[model samples]
Target: MSRLELAAARLAKALDDLETVVSPLAKARESAAVAETKIAALDAEREALVARVATLEDEARALSGLTEEVEDRLDGAIAEIRTALSR
Candidate 1:
């Protein structure tokens, strides 16, 4: 083969080798970018869930207070009925 042809063949092989080495690195970079986006979305979702849980906790506390008040009133009524019956 002529020297020019040998040079061209070497160049083509070098280009192929470079692509093989670089392809995985390129794919990894793309995957990392996607993972970062997903992590950001998950963080926002977690924040929303935390806020919702806080609101639910507050509502539950209010309901607990109301339940205690109702139980106290019921107990008092029961005591009054017992006293009247004993008479």
Candidate 2:
């Protein structure tokens, strides 16, 4: 072959070899990007769940306080009824 044709063939072969090496690296980079996106989504979900749990815990504490108040009133009423009956 002529020198120019030989040079072109060598350049083409080098490009093919480079592509073979770079193809897997490109795929690995894409997979890493996808994994990062999934991790971000999971983190957001976890934050929302943590906030919901905190709200539920606050509600539970308020309910406990209300329960105590109701019990105290009931006990006082029962004592008053017993005293009236004895009189």
Candidate 3:
């Protein structure tokens, strides 16, 4: 082959190699963007769950105080009956 023709062939081969290399890189970038979107959605869901947990905890605390008051009243009634019977 003439030197000019040989040089042209080499250039074509190099262009094919570059296309193959760049295509996968573009696909990888698209995949990364999709992954980031999913991560943001998951983070928002986690924050909502945390808020629900806090509300449940507050309700449980209020119920605990009510139980304590009921227990105290029962104990006092029992003590008063025992004292009257002993007198």
lDDT of 2 by residue, 1-87 (tens): 999999999999999999999999999999999999999999999999999999999999999999999999999999999999999
Q: Clashing residue pairs in candidate 1, if any?
A: none
* Model 1 per-residue lDDT tens digits across residues 1-87: 999999999999999999999999999999999999999999999999999999999999999999999999999999999999999
Predictions: Cα RMSD each: 1.7, 2.6, 2.3
Q: Tens digit of lDDT per residue, candidate 3, span 1-87?
A: 999999999999999999999999999999999999999999999999999999999999999999999999999999999999999
lDDT of 1: 1.00
By TM-score, the better pick of 1 and 3 is: 1
TM-score, prediction 3: 0.74
The candidate, 1 or 3, that scores higher on lDDT is 1
Among these predictions, the greatest TM-score belongs to 1
lDDT of each: 1.00, 1.00, 0.97
TM-score of each: 0.83, 0.70, 0.74
Query: For model 2, what is the error of residue 55's alpha carbon versus the real structure, in angstroms, after optimal superposition?
Result: 1.2
